[model samples]
Target: MRADAKKNREQVLAAAGIAISEQGVDVSLRDVSRRAGVGLATLLRHYPTREALLEALLHTSFAELTAKAGELETSSSPEEALVSWLRDCTAWTTQYQGVTELMAAAIEDVESALHASCVALRAAGARLLTRAQAAGAARADIDGTDLFALVAALAWVGDQPSLESRADHLFDVVVSAILTCAPVLGDRRPTEEVSS
Candidate 1:
């Protein structure tokens, strides 16, 4: 891409991020172009579609989250790692008004532009859940799909004005429900003693 084209694309994405935060995934493409101070033709030339734009916007964040899950897996306790990742996922999702809906749909649609990124993200969360389950920190019954769904549900709460205030508390509630027992500090417990 030419320097100017790259610059225009970046501007569009930044403006889209702002517009989406304010108005959501359904925000008008024209509004995004207007905000970016670019012509609609330029924005379309770069992204072509809402999903394409979203795919570009969400790709980096999704990669960071997946990487974070990996880092947490190594640096934190099984329970702590899972909770932290879940919280991060939920909080990040709340930044985009209707992203949870897109994510949920994208994960199921193999042909969708966002499918690959969503699947990778889901796999990352699943790894954390599996690790926690093996350590007797989380319930064995729930799988990665369940974990991803919980994140979407939790994020949806944060998006709603009425429920936004309760989002943090609800997050804790969901975490507790997912975990086999409350988190322990200091030395990790033997899986046998954890007693899910």
Candidate 2:
């Protein structure tokens, strides 16, 4: 790519990140172009579709999360690895508005630009989950698919304004449910003390 073209692509991607973070995956291409100070045609030239733009934006994050899962698998106990990775993954999904839906859809569609990255990320989490189950720490009935769905569910619940306050409590509940041998209540964080 020419230097100018590369610079233009970077600007569009940067703008798209800001737009999507603020307005979600559904944010219009026009809005992103406007924010980038580029013409719509230029944006289209760089990212032909919303999925393409999202793939560019999230692929790095997905790789990092996958790497994190690998690190946790080696460094933490089975149960701790699963719980920490779950928490981190769920927290990540909450960053971009409506991204849970995008990730769910992308993972199921091989033609989607994000399919590969999403699958890799899911596999990383699955490794952690399997480790936990093998150690008799996490529930054996659930598999990686179930775990991904649960993460997406948690992200969706956290996305709602009415449930935002309850998200942490809900996370704890989900974590407890995932564990075959639950942690002592006192060992948990996040003020399980929400007098709600």
Candidate 3:
């Protein structure tokens, strides 16, 4: 890309990030263009649609979460890794207002621009889940897709004003239910049978 074009893209993304964070995912693209000091044509040329713009804004975060899953797989016990990463996913989804809903929709819509990123993010969680199950820490009946859904659900709940404080308790309860052998309370390590 030409220097000027790249600059325009960056500006649009930056302005969109602020607008979306402050206003919402539904913030006007025209406003984004105005904030970025770019024309509507240029904004459309770069992002094409609101979903495309959101995808661009969230791509880096999704990629980082995916990479973090890989790192956690090696650094923490399987159960610990899964639990830690789920918390991270929740935080990521709730970064801005209404993002959890957008993510839930995007993950199911193959046609959406954000779908690929959502898929990659879910795949990462699935990898950790697979490892946890294989190690006999997680329930064998559940799959990566199931884990992804649970994460999304928790994020959705977290987004609710009345449920925000209960999110951690809900996470713990759900995660415990998903485990084959319940983890010791407050302990992140896998059980002796699984670890050995």
Candidate whose lDDT is highest: 1
Clashing pairs for predicted structure model 2, backbone only: none
lDDT of 2: 0.90
Please give the distance, in angstroms, between residue 94's alpha carbon in candidate 2 and its true position after superposition: 0.8
User: Candidate 2's error at 123, in angstroms?
Assistant: 0.8
Clashes of each: 0, 0, 0
Q: Tens-digit lDDT track for model 2 on 32-147? A: 99999999999999899988888998999999999999999899999988988998999999989989999999899999999999999999999999999999999899988899
In model 2, which regions exceed 4 Å deviation? 184-196
lDDT of 1 at 128: 97
Count residue pairs with overlapping backbones in model 2.
0
> What is the descending lDDT order?
1, 2, 3
TM-score for every candidate vs. truth?
0.92, 0.92, 0.84
Better of 1 and 2 by TM-score: 1
User: Model 3 over residues 1-196: C-alpha lDDT tens digits?
Assistant: 9999999999999999889877879999999999999999999999998988999999999999999999999999999899889889987776677787787788889998889988999899999999998998998898878888898788788778777766777777888898877666464332222335
Provide the RMSD of all predictions against the true structure, rounded to 1 decimal: 6.9, 2.4, 6.8
Off by over 4 Å in 3: 182-196
Which ranges in model 1 have alpha carbons more than 4 Å from their true place? 184-196
